[model samples]
Target chain A: MVNTILIMAGVLMALGILLALFRFILGPDVTDRAIAFDVMTVSSISVIALIAYFAGRVIYLDVALVYGLLSFLSVVVIGRYIERGL
Target chain B: MEIRETVGAAVTLLGSVFIFLGGLGIVRMPDLFNRIQAGTKASTLGTILSLLGLAIMNEAWIWKLLVIIFFVLITNPISSNVISRAAHFRGTRMTNKTVADLLSDKNKKISEE
Candidate 1:
């Protein structure tokens, strides 16, 4: 039952990632793309968490933590560049 | 134990659905700020719920999941705010239905000073 649910969650998240990717590629403006990228990162974090649960690895939580931080930093940097002349 | 696993999995599945809706919002929203708002709000909740579900499934990692949840909640909105502000400053065109220009006056004041 647990495996079945995890597989279902994985499929749903994969579909979400595909939508995010579509936005990222077809976005008219850089900010639109950035927004899509942000969504993608968050979804990926959830995916990582689900994967960890499936694998029964506590260590993967640490990976999720780092990835979340990196995603935040990347978004901030992108925002700064877009706001200014960078 | 079986009941706990089933409940956790159900919660996780719901969270994933929210995340999918957020992604859909990003693709369908009319403007940059709208997309940012949709993506940030929905995904934050989605991620938190999924993490909480995972914590429930694995009792030992509850503390670590709590920490991750804290980081996600803190950073998600801040990044979204930064992005929206950037888009505003960069003069990304707004949709026709936009109702307010609260930031325009502030931007003028800043430029004047």
Candidate 2:
């Protein structure tokens, strides 16, 4: 049962990544791409969490946490740069 | 034990579904702000749910999962708000159906004063 769930979640994450990639590539505006990138990061965090569960490793959770922080910082910096000539 | 594992798996699966929907919304939304709103809310909740599910599966890592959830909750909205504000300031065009823009009105008042 656990294996089945892991497989299903992996498939869904793959689909989500594909959709996010489409938006990131096709988005007309910079902000649109920024939003798409944000979505991708969030999905990646979930994927990492799933991997941690599947592998029974706790270290990946720390990686997810760090990745979340980095994503937030990147989005904020990009937003600021877009708003002003920074 | 079997029941607990099943429940956790189900929750994680549901979270994945929401994440997928968030990506779909980002692709399909007509405007930038709409996409940000959709992506932010859905992804935030999906992430938290997935983390919670993982915690359920691994009881020893519950504290770490909770920390990640809290971090996500705080950061997601802040990043979305910053992006939307920046986009608005940069004159990203809104859809024609947008009835009112309070930020623009406020800016006008400031300029007039």
Candidate 3:
């Protein structure tokens, strides 16, 4: 049951990533692209965890954990650059 | 066992709805502020619940999931706020549907006077 639910999340996250990609491309400004990138990070995290469940591996959970941290760092760096670079 | 499975099923369904709402917000919201608020809140709730369901269904993964949740709780809103502030600073200009410009309007008044 968890596996099935994870798969559903994976599918939704994939769709969300694609939409975010569209935003990244079509966004009118750097900040818009940055927000889209942030969303993409989140969607990717959900997908990664779901795949871990599908494969029945605990190792991927660690990788997902790392990705979550990295995504946060990336967002912070980007945000700081945007705020202070002016 | 029955109750555990039932609770898992309910949470899973509700979590999916929240995730879907988060995704819809990302794709559909007309402005950055709206998208950030909707996307962050909905997805955070959704992912936390989903992680809880995973922990419940597969007990061994609970520790790792908890760690991931901790990271998520700290990062999600911070990123949203940072990006929204950046967008406001960059003068991205909101759609007509928006009712508030809490930060920008204040900045504008100060700069004007």
Off by over 4 Å in 1: B105-113
**TM-score versus the correct structure, for each prediction:** 0.94, 0.96, 0.86
Where model 2 places Cα greater than 4 Å from the true spot, the runs are none
| Tens-digit lDDT string for candidate 3 (B1-113) | 75675566456556656776776776788878777877778878877887777677677778888999888888898888888777777788788987776777788899999
Using alpha carbons, what is the TM-score of model 3? Answer: 0.86
Q: Write the per-residue lDDT of candidate 2 for residues B1-113, one digit (tens) a residue.
A: 98888888888888888888888888888999888877778878888887788778778999999999999999999999999999999889998888899989999999999
Every model's DockQ, to 2 decimals? 0.86, 0.87, 0.52
Clashing pairs in 2: none
Instruction: Give the Cα error of residue B57 in candidate 1, in Å.
Output: 1.0
- Give a tens-digit lDDT track for model 1, residues A1-86: 88898789888888888998999999998888888888899889989888787788889989989998998999999999988857
Docking class of 2: high
Q: Native contact fraction of candidate 1?
A: 0.88
* Cand. 2 Cα-lDDT: 0.88
lDDT of 1 by residue, B1-113 (tens): 99998898888888888888888888888888888877778888888988888888889999999999999889988999999888888888999999988889788899999
Instruction: Pull out the clashing pairs in model 3.
Output: none
CA deviation > 4 Å runs, candidate 3: A1-5, B1-10
